[model samples]
Target chain A: MHFHKYEKIWLIFGSGSLIVFLMVLGFAAFWKGTHPQSHIETIDPQNIEAHEAFQAENLGLHEVEDGKYIVNIVASAFNYDLGKDENGDIVKTIRVPKGSSVLFQITTRDVVHGFQVAGTNVNMMVEPGHISRFETVLKNNGEFTIVCNEYCGIGHHLMFGTVEVY
Target chain B: MSTKQLTFSKQESTLYMVFMHVTFVSLLIGGLMGLLQTLVRSGKYTLPFNIDYYTILTVHGVILGLVLTTFFIIGFQFSLLGKTVGISKKQLRAAWLSFWVMLVGTVMAAITILIGEASVLFTFYAPLQAHPAFYFGLAFVIIGSWIAAITNFRQLYVWKKANKGQKSPLLAFMVTINMAMWVIASLGVATAVLIQFIPWSLGYAETINVLLTRTLFWYFGHPLVYFWLLPAYMAWYAIIPKIIGGKLFSDSLARLAFILLLMFSIPVGFHHQLTEPGIDPTWKFIQVVLTFMVIIPSLMTAFSIFATFEITGRRKGYRGVFGWFRKLPWKDVRFLAPFIGMLAFIPGGAGGIINASHQMNSLIHNTIWVTGHFHLTAATTVILTFFGIAYWLIPHLTGRTLTAKLNRLGILQTIIWTVGMTIMSTSMHIQGLLGGPRRSNFSEYAGGEQVATWINYQLAQAIGGSILFIGIILMVYIFIQLAFFAPRGHEEYPIAEEESDALPTPKVLENWYLWVGLTIALILFAYTIPVIDIIKHSPPGSVPFSWPIGRS
Candidate 1:
């Protein structure tokens, strides 16, 4: 019903701090295109292998418009295919050229898993029957490891993939 | 009836005794599991048994997060209620019943977890289901808590009926806000568990919409943290100032904060789902904004609390800038523990801002940074306050004076806890920035070389975590020593008086129904679209897959 003068001042100062925080987040999401990956692509897990785009050979680096490179991945119980080797073996490295907008389109065959590249702001929950996608410019040149931060099963900790930025 | 007419009876003390015993035991078990997992996770040692990592992690999280905090808060609130508005014989009976039911539920759940049929962690959403007993046991615990909350509400209702025009005492009012919030918050997880998770675990369903369950879980999850923190806030409001020889800065401000917490905490669970799909980004952004709005109350709390320190410090012949800060009783464990808890919360609140942002959430969403942030928030602030509470409460319950030796141990426990938590959380935060994932035992991340840099931090966390275990063991011993065999003396329940005010608060502040109604409505407004879309877009029924971890 009543306020101490200092209490009222504190309330105002606290509210002002909040406004500043929200404004920075708003600026980044709306203006600077720095929002978390929300909309990119989707694929049902049950039919992922049969889907033409995710078939072994079709999963590598590809130009999807002008500067965008898409890496389609089908993650299962404990592993994700970063790309294919020369003999068609599943390689652990997801190689993308530097300064390119690379989109990681990831989905799981069973259970929920997280596709998180630890060093960069590239993370999403790869779910069963739904795809999780994130597109980010591979600005820094380094080898970044991707780990399944979500607890899927017993081997959750051993689940790691790599992003090689050149 | 006024304050003196409602002194806490011995029956209520026994109830406090029962609840606090549960808290300490749970704290002990949880701390042990936590210690083991930290070491194993560091790649420094193998888990002694054939038992694996996530199982230990699940036990650690559930025991500490759910069991310890719940039992302690419920137990502590009984004393609060008894002190403010006397608990009837009937209410005491109900409280005991609630305690037994909760204990049974905890045992049932613990059995399932120990047998390794429920390795799904605390946020075990649908599709990754646990044993049927695990879900059922958890539901029982919720129901037991619901019974306790309902009994509490009844006490408040009866108090209101008798004293029609009087403002509810601050302690009673604070407890009710948390209880009401808990009751409403539990529903979301209850629905997920009852209609979906339990049935799925029992083979009653073939598929489930993971998005719906996740949405529901976080709906409960975020508020659950507030529920944990509110008791600490209560201590800060009612007791901390008294310990420092001052009164609450403003009672109305404290109530305003709790009211805002009840309203805003539920609707903003979607902030946790920012990294996941199926929720619209616009809805996420809206929820994120609400999440930021929630920050105001905590910041106000920071200012109000620090102001008390200043006022008290000024009284003690300390004057001018930062001199007041120097006047705080740093040697008294009762003051020191909670004060340090509040200090840790400053960063905790700041880290939450990053987690709740759409732009920044991506950077730390699944990283150990999130883990580090929460450890500082709930684990540090809430646990440390509870430890401080134990210092006085155990003595009160047991009718003993905490001797000089035990008090020295108490102070050492607080200092050890702070040092360990600082090292552990700081390393976790930096490693998170370097992309170390939380909840993972990453012995090899993309093979050996890439993870080489993380080993030192991992070892640092292990060392810190080990020290924390020593602190827990010491605190538990002190609690036991105080409770069972210490010399008898009259112990006081710490409660502060407020400076003279207009006697009763404005009737509008006492309008509890309106505040709770708005809370429920906001929850509906925020959740309606996303929940509806989750059901509409996804196919039905997700079958439970058994966990692969070994039995204890």
Candidate 2:
């Protein structure tokens, strides 16, 4: 097929840009080890408690090392179970020291839910029977609201939590 | 002036008009639902009459996104076929059958959603199941669309057989590619519905494999957007050149773009599921690569369009590198509307790339930004072009003329839509970056500080949505005048011609078996392994939940 001179030039530029984008994404994935929150591990949605990490006592934040932590969360309709505070009240807020690396492992017991720390680069689609995980360093000190970005149910808007780095 | 006017027969015209009627009514209803959503999301007003926000959201998505677009596209495609390649009486009969079945399905789905039985939104993700009727309704809609696809294919086949060695008309070729893609891609969702959703929703099954259902939906879902878009591309590539007083830039380039789009559009569904688990990152990256390959055709399309404009303008005695741009018919709604649509696609296309990027999807996944992205692509770019088509197509089909007054009103309507969309979509993007969610009703998020940051944007969305509602009202009025009240006269069904020295379109591009074979091969390559992995190591299925919105 014949291409006009200018058309050929435009295609080169356009295709080059797409190639550059793909290269950058490849670098991020293969070199930097960047991936979306895909865990590829499954657990029973109906019997999530049977999974070790999802058991009530095991859920929520755990200090794995100095300046490092892991938070296991169970998401359901309009709720994010972030374990409990010392007072036994449902832990609605998770506090961590600034400059800490945090890994969030989350799953939903019901429909598909979205776990997003608003105003940050932390997000995952928390689906039943699969674990969705995202790890990021808390470089900034502030309170970030965690919201369900996916439409789960009627009270989808009601689902939320908080992450405080200090 | 001795050439005969190309027009649809009266029977063909009447059939298309009926489709247009459904299209406009859907615009009104869906537009109203959209207005209500923005209002409720603003937290300034509550839905009265015990109505739920999710219901209206579902209505807005289904009616406008699915119903209006499908009816307009199929109707418009039929006309294109009728004008280019004669539709057989048998084919016409089949076309009408498709229309009725689709209409019945639409009514069933609409009534089910309106009564709040299926507020699962347009994706209708599994586990959050809708009523059996809703699933059946959607199945019928898909089946009906398949019938239309077969009819379109037959229309072209008959023409090709009689012509013996001629290139088919460009628009008919495009319509066939689109329907071919639609039929093949929709099979994924059709299978999911028939095998998974219908039985599960009807309580014949105890639980659903959520990931499996979602995968199938996105397999269809990604191309579903392209299905909305290719028709607009049809207008942009073929129809717009005629409206702009230019020949096609290159017939070969346009065909190549459609062919590329068909090959790359379907196998990339994993990009939508990038943030989900149970899918390996390798496969996700593979599909993401395929997704980017789809962009090349669009890039080609952009070049072809610009070349068309420049060449046409230069031919019109305009001189200077950019003078051709100034030579376009700014006053004509048929050109202006689609031109604006073209302009919107720049940002729309850019945002689409961002959304599909493998890891970067986390930045905007499920955020209102994603919503904003589509508002630009589908709602503005595609819908505006469809509006542009309506400005003439409606009148052409109805044997009426678009009076100057209506044309001016159309310009005003276009302006209103552009402004409204800019405001709403911009605010949606910003609020989403600030971490606001899409498809959610109003909430302060327990008075969180970030939630406070989104309120002003929500209010702006409401203001913008209200303006869009007014634009819709104006559009409906213009449709009425163009359809029934305008002076009876001949309106051209503008189809652009090839330039005198344009290269012959390669016969290889028309080899359906080769293209379709490549398309399926790519799909299987991208999806086969990952899909098998999802099923093999599957998580336990969950029973259906309908307490919040779906029927019990």
Candidate 3:
């Protein structure tokens, strides 16, 4: 029970650990300060106007050949449900055109997020200061869930996006 | 006729032997899988690579990564901490049960993956589903591991109960931290599997949230690496000195590092998801900063352990920063484990610092660079420590002295491990920088000339992997020889000198550092969770459906 006298040893250990912990904390703080802020700034998918207008045309065609269509994809570590039925089931689908290659330039305004076009071989990482490019051939037209493959935060799994191949 | 029953000590030894047997068998299976993958991928043998790649890859990951590591943890826990904590017969039996469940589950999982029924990378990302049995088997294995973690903590708690005010023995404290981390990490995955993935795959839960499962898994997955590394650190802190003719430099530092590991390791799991698009970049950045922050304990450990070596070397009359190196026993497996581990630490730590850097991480995230980085840290450093512990401790536990010649060969095994890891890691980093993707089954040439020369690198990788496998086999042989053929005469074993022995516990065991550590854990955990919660409930922007607020 005489650990009190061992303060010398504990101090050696404690002080050493404290210094290192502080150094690392300093590094993280410095890095965080230098990096740009990464919060969801805008969500175009939720725009009712954009949804209804592009409902027929954008039915899975993420991009057009030489035609500029502005679609904003927000990157989140937590889960976001892109496909859910009216009955609160995951039955909602996306429709994509067949025999077309679409360029899906995804960027994360916030923390790291994964853009995985499920079942058709698409998985890309979106970082704040970076744009992740995924160009894929729409071989088969079916509803695909663009799920996040990376573990963001607690809600990382619910952060899903929808892509329909028509 | 008189019947001679074995003592509980003997029983523990038998239990330890069973785990080692499982380890050697798993290594052989993993090695064979590696060899087969090499042959087929190199086109040296003409066989349909179709299902074989997935099957072999799964087997390789399961055996080497999870199963082997699990066995090592159990064995190390029983051998080192068990004695110190004075684990009870009932709890020891419980530990035995945990081991069996893990072994059985591993077998089931390996068989399922081998048949191409479960091709999901051990990551087991959702939607890209696998056989239900595969998930169940994994669940079983984890449940068993959870049991082991619980038992370890329970033993420590009981020890604390019996010997209140006495500081938990150094080894017990480290193992306790490891066990605590295991419980928290596993809960994340267990929740996903039990509530979401398992039920969804079994047709019980309709429309499972893929995002939730990933969040849960990585929460579990990242700390799981620490679970693997901390025991090796224990061996370094607690055992390395005895082998090298010196006492531990500072037990308090060892304990403090464990506390830091438990505190910082879990919350920083988000860094792994940085490249993914689902999470807020702000939080990802926070996690990255935290990830770098976690390096503090690592640096402290490096300084403390190295300082321990210096103090020990000075005691032995060696002088200088590198001068301490001369006094070290180069050929002793016990000595070589920490030496090689620290040597690999140089690159491994550098890789970690690089990977944790937000901008630099972008360059090599999910590429062969990440693969190379972890190989040096996890495979080379940690596994070498495992070998050293087995070489030094197993004989003592079994009342034996191993053949010094094979122990010398065991040092050679560590050399092979170090060399093979360096070659593979350096080559993989180069390949990743040249834009080679990681976790890919096949590599294709971008043009007629192969844009990144990925094919050559992949070929080189297989060769390096094979060498690593051979080195693993050498380890298996050395351990098996120690267990079965080594002379089990307790009287003949050498006793360490007084000066070389670890200092016994001090008079007053109650220390403020322990409470201070717990306080920090509380603050850090408290600080991070709410930030995560605020982000969770805030409007998810036009992320498809009107985002559910506060669903959980």
Candidate 4:
């Protein structure tokens, strides 16, 4: 019950800092609409192709507007099914122009995986049966590697892709 | 109370010693696994004997994170109970049963992991299932801990009944609070294991509900860290003060912190699931708020610790603002090790706040920064405090003394550990900021430019880890010395007394019904709606995938 004068002062300083942190977090989450990659819609892991976004024709980048795009990806153990390019080659590196706003919509068929465009704020936990989504503008014209941060399986480290912004 | 009254009985000492023995063995094994992990990740050495990297990673996580911490905490808490409130013969017998059950379970699980059947990592997220025996073994471990928790509660309950109206001993009350939280929180994991994992892994069920199982795990997972933490807090609050020749700064304040931790730790597991899908962001935000509430108690603890040092030093005629800090016993390992633990928590606590910050979790969520954060918090702050306790506790129990020579060795060991962790954790944080992922084996990532940036940090981690392995070797040597080879003498079991002029601790602080009731209410409020939403709007369950990681 007895708080030394210094103890009280320390408590005030500590609590004040914590409160400031909470206020900033709240402003980002509630006011600025900053949330993690949580999408409420459930997709069937076994039958992902049945879902509109995950169908073969829709698995890669599609420009919804001049500078806005959505990339649908299906993550599996040891691989990211990033759809094919015009030359019928698997799209390992996604290319977009600088200043383009891209929304990555991803899900997994087996086990939990991670979708993180390294060195960017685009990170998400792609779980089975749920679509994880993160939208960010390609501000820097550089190649960002996409690595699976979650331990999906033995070849977890081998699972990586690239995003090039020109 | 006389020293004789507080001393553990011969049988009691043996029981606690068994736990200590298991703890040290785990430290060595787990420490080795960690060293190997760093070496492998450095992109220099490959694991020989066809040993998979994930297997060793699982070993490190399970042995250190689960086995070492659990055995040490339960054993240490039992000793606290025996010292503070006399444990009956019946309670002692039950404690032994708990120990055996836990040991058996640990062996079963350990063998399974060793033989390459359960490399699912310590978290063991379902759908990537392990062997059924692994699940069974983990279940037995939980049940065994339940026994220990029950014994602790009964020990304190008997004491309260006999000495009606008297407040319980501070350490005993703290032990009870921790046990109560453990029981309540572990129910989530226990349910997942018994009902979901066991059935699915055994092929009785065709598929496992992924989100449901994870929700249940994190329900227990967040509190799992606090379970490792509160015991260290126990030593910091009660024992460390006495070691420093000071009385407890405030009895009520310490009790209040424990109560608050119990309340806030459980309901906030959603913070871990923030980056995952299926869970609503609103629930995550709410739990994030609750997680921040838990920080209040830790902040209070920081203040109390500083105040205890300053007041004690001033009493010894130290004058300047920082003179009190200088007055602390730097040469004594008993004080020095835990002091370093306290120093580590400053950064560790800051990292935790950032990790739990709603959207900010994206910055380091699954990155090596999170790994660095915990190494500082659990591995440094908590483990170092345990070492500090061991320097005296082991000798005190074994009728031996921490010889001045061994004390010097302890100081050296502490320095080695500090240097090693600083280098390792610092590099981890830097690499994580540069987009390095955790829980992966060594990879060049096809020579990507960003991947190239992480190699130097990885090499630094390997160096740091090798040094840490050396520290572990020294610690184990010191443990062996203190347990058997130290000089035979009475090493005082220091328990600080409440200051004579301090205000009486409020009766409400001891009101278990009120506290536990509030704890339950908060957990329900935080969990119920989100949980229902997860199950109601559920995804189709998936069959097991054990090909790459686990044996069928």
Chain B superposition TM-score per model: 0.97, 0.99, 0.88, 0.99
Q: After superposition, which runs of candidate 1 have C-alpha atoms over 4 Å from their true positions?
A: A40-43, A64-67, B1-5, B501-504, B547-552
What is the Å distance of residue B13 in model 1 from its true position? 1.5
lDDT agreement with native, every candidate: 0.83, 0.91, 0.63, 0.92
For residues B1-552, write the lDDT of model 2, one tens digit per residue. Answer: 002235578998999999999999999999999999999999989999989999999999999989999999999999988888878789999999999999999999999999999999999987897889999999999999999999999998998998788888888899999999999999999999999999998888998999999999999999999999999999999889999898888787899999999999999999999999999999999999999999999998988888889888998999998988887999999999999999999999999999998999998999999889999999999999999999999999889999999999999999999999999999999998788889999998867667888988999999999999999999999999999999999888888888777778889989999999999999999999999999899988988989856455
Q: Retained native contacts per candidate, as fractions?
A: 0.57, 0.84, 0.09, 0.79
* Candidate 1 C-alpha lDDT tens digits along B132-230: 888888998999999999999998888888988887888899999999999999998999889988767777777777878888899999999999999
lDDT of 3 by residue, B1-552 (tens): 001112337777777767777877877888777666655545455346444454566677778888888887877776555557666789889989999898778878887777666766567665445667888888889899888888887887897788766667677777777877787778888887777667767776644444456667877787888888998888777767667766666665566667677777777766665445445555665666566556767766776677667778887788766888777788777778667887887888887766765544555666667778878887778877877777756676667776778778887888787777777778888876654555544523212233227667777777787788889788878877777778876512111222324455453333435644663564366336634643464333212111111111
What is each candidate's DockQ, to 2 decimals? 0.60, 0.82, 0.09, 0.80
Query: Which of the numbered candidates is closest to the native, going by highest lDDT?
Result: 4
Candidate 1 chain B: 10-residue stretch with minimal lDDT: B543-552
Error of 4 at B195 (Å): 0.8
| Winner of 3 and 4 under TM-score | 4
* Model 2 RMSD, rounded to 1 decimal: 1.4
Candidate 4 residues lying further than 4 Å off, grouped into runs, are: B1-5, B550-552
TM-score of chain A of each: 0.87, 0.96, 0.50, 0.97
Candidate 4 residue lDDT tens string, B180-220: 99999999999999999998988899988899999999999
lDDT of 2 by residue, A38-152 (tens): 8878888889998788999988899999999999999999799999877888998899999999999998888889999987789899888888888999898788989999999
The interface RMSD values of the models, given in order, are: 2.2, 1.1, 11.5, 1.1
What are the C-alpha RMSDs, in order, of all predicted structures?
1.9, 1.4, 9.9, 1.2
